[model samples]
Target: MTTLHLEHASHAHIHGPACGHTQVPHGDHVDYAHDGHLHREHGGHWDECEPDGHAPHEGHDHRHGEGCGHESVLHGDHVDYLHDGHRHAPHDGHWDDH
Candidate 1:
């Protein structure tokens, strides 16, 4: 089972191949923001299978190379505020502290 946790602001999306289920961690927040209040996010689907038609238990490369099927976040109009592994303050229109 491969678990991937993605969080942005109060939104989050969790994906894995444990029970063949891919669920968004945002829960009720996703439903409430369905009326175009938020941007429509897209992501890649991760599986527990390898290229050799076997389970990716060990010796599997999880790199961000081509064909690795890695998910990435793309920021469009909104300011991308990533607070992973660090703390950041909300600065209007500027991400860098000067």
Candidate 2:
């Protein structure tokens, strides 16, 4: 993971189940995938959300790639495969929860 400066959204729009965006559970909060970036609601505003560290997916023997039978999302610098409501990215000979 990399250090990222979170930026607030310009518009005053609330994100939730009815927001029509993909909701991804990250840590203790839910992230909304919008306009090719992840957004999280904070203090009546929206902030850009990014992972803070490498969270390895233990016991993940399946490798994700072309024809892996999962939806691949283009995250920052890598591709994340959506599996069972979680996003998995390939890293360090294993998969990381991104």
lDDT of 1 by residue, 1-98 (tens): 22233323444444333422322223221211121122224344222221122232233223332353432222233221222221111233223210
CA RMSD (A), model 2: 3.1
**C-alpha lDDT (0 to 100) for residue 4 of candidate 1:** 30
lDDT, model 1, position 50: 10
- Which residue pairs clash within candidate 2? none
TM-score of each model, in listed order: 0.16, 0.71
TM-score attained by model 1: 0.16
Candidate 2 residue-wise lDDT, 1-98, digit = tens = 54255866485777889998778777677878777767888777788887778889999999899998987766777777778777898988999887
- Candidate 1 residue runs with Cα over 4 Å from true position: 1-27, 31-61, 76-98
Q: Give lDDT per model, in order.
A: 0.26, 0.78
